[model samples]
Target: MRASESDTWLAKMISPQSEDESEDDILYNDRKFSWSAGYPHWEIFGGGTRVVATDALTSSSLFSLTEAVAEIIKREKVTHAVLIQPVIDILMKEQIAIKLKKIVILGTVGFRSVLDCVGKICDELVNMYGMVEFGTIAAGSYRVNDVNTYKHKVLSVKPLPGVELKVTDDNGHLVPVGDRGLIQVRSQKRFTGYLNHASRWVDQLVRTGWLNSSDGGYITTDGFMVIEGRINGLMDVFGLKVYPFQVENAIKGMKAISNAVVIPIREKETKFCVPCAAVVYHPGSENTTQNIQEYIREEFAFTKENPIMASVYVPQVVVKFKTFPQTSNGKPDRHGIAAEVKRQIDPKKYECIE
Candidate 1:
């Protein structure tokens, strides 16, 4: 099917209005298309079909509760599967194996860690990037045997057909390849406007066609896109900018940490924001708070050229969590965790780095 038509069908399927509309009304709108018409069914494996499973909240756009139930009923052997990062984490924690041939992972945060865990189970693993506003933007896959060697490409995604991406500096000028900047996207099949939020749409539109993704990332010289994190999520510490993903990625790289989230917490006296990390350690890990803190210091200290800037990235306070609070869509609840971190931290005990 064409991209525009596919988008229209997806929008209708997930829109709030869809709850009131009948299946026929959703499938046979003004386009006059049938539900099964032109639906391409690819034989990804030898006579094996794909089965999807999601634990996301019902309100998630990825799949409705009803669709999830139907898919669950139809699933049997589960040769191919699609899952989000959180679901994959759960699988790893539970020590459950589905014995799948192929898997496609949806979300971005902590993708590398999850890929490392699941790469051994499946023959092929694909990392997909997309949002509700636009359909599948970019995707890349790695074979099971190449997992360790291709770790650098875990977050790299190549744009899909007809999708255009650019990284621009704060001044709205394009940056050189491999330089970090604000990421913007333009596509022929992109959503036009919000239901009643036209002004919001206008604010995000950089020009007539391009839309500001509000994401900070860089493009590689080889033409792959790498998303760092949300532009708004960047923390300013003593006049230095630090990306939470960079810190979280470093923390997760440690042998003990299973998952981690870094947030900016403002110091009471100076009112300056400092990075605080909440971590989930692997089962049976005997590492203490001091060990994790020392690890971060050593990791950031390796950069001799920017010791001052690297110091800002280190977390002043570290808290341990059994598991991260999750949002409705099953992603880590960063804001909620930040609130809890503030509550747990005693301002008098830990002072901000000067």
Candidate 2:
């Protein structure tokens, strides 16, 4: 398609949309416009009355998704909006809710599933607009499947809203239910191959029906997959596989701990290894080292592996100055925090007490 023609087509797809249009059609167009809702904001039409803002209400399409969300809420005139996954609506600077006459979300794996992450937005809409008149979330990609034609094709899935795709692991078969593994996705819309590699494509049907989806998840009895963290975050101590979120959740509710990251540190004396968790305490709270150690010890008793019984207790919890570094979507950057913890911990003082 010519650039101008393509732009027009895209404009219609991402447009803030109106109540009169059919919901399914609007969702399809928006995905065609941009899968991740690039930038933050995009104007719905040439001279339309409404705008989509990620930050607040504004009349511009050439902005970030965050900005577009902001604009839509401020205008409050928009009767309908197609909120692509990962796109958030901010109110008074925090993501209070996504406002639209009607809102539809596309779903995928991970915590940002339309229902999980979008609850707060839905709540805000109810509080302000007296309940959502119409809302729904579905797994089908609005871009890949030509809802009108309904043709089935491979590698036609849309790209994730904003994130890179890589082969996280290649040696193993898909893990059993409840086990975590790599997340792999095969898509033609993905950016070009790396510097040393030639352009490549994965035939999901040949090796596995779906892209590896390097993320680790387990098939719940109810049939929904629960995405655990990444493959890189999985730790094996004395043969028991450890998922950080499992540990984080155990300690997350503690009143004194703001956050926690579990890391595997090698011991020089025994030439063996075990997990060590560096916790960030609530600001201004006097964090006593003894109490923190006891917390980890007590919490792990409820876990499947119970690493605290085998691993050494960390001496001083690394207190970061502020919030943990976050990926673009606001998920804590565990790898980044692990690196920071390694740098801060003194090697000579590496001693674990049971």
* Best lDDT among the predictions, by candidate number: 1
The residue ranges of model 2 lying beyond 4 angstroms of the native Cα positions read 1-121, 124-206, 236-241, 253-259, 278-321, 326-336, 351-354
**Which tens-of-lDDT digit does each residue in 1-354 have in candidate 1?**
111112122322223221333545222223322211122112212232331222122434222432453355247766777665545554555555455677776645435666665455567778777644566777877776656655442377888998888899877799999888988788766454554434443465636577776667788777888876566577788888887877887787776776788888777776778788899876566467777767877866756676666558877788888777764334567767876776788967544332
The candidate 1 region of ten consecutive residues with least summed lDDT is 35-44
lDDT of 2: 0.40
RMSD of each candidate relative to the true structure: 8.7, 13.1
* C-alpha lDDT score of every prediction, in listed order: 0.62, 0.40
Q: Tens digits of per-residue lDDT for model 2 on 308-330?
A: 54354332344343445643323
Error of 1 at 264 (Å): 1.4
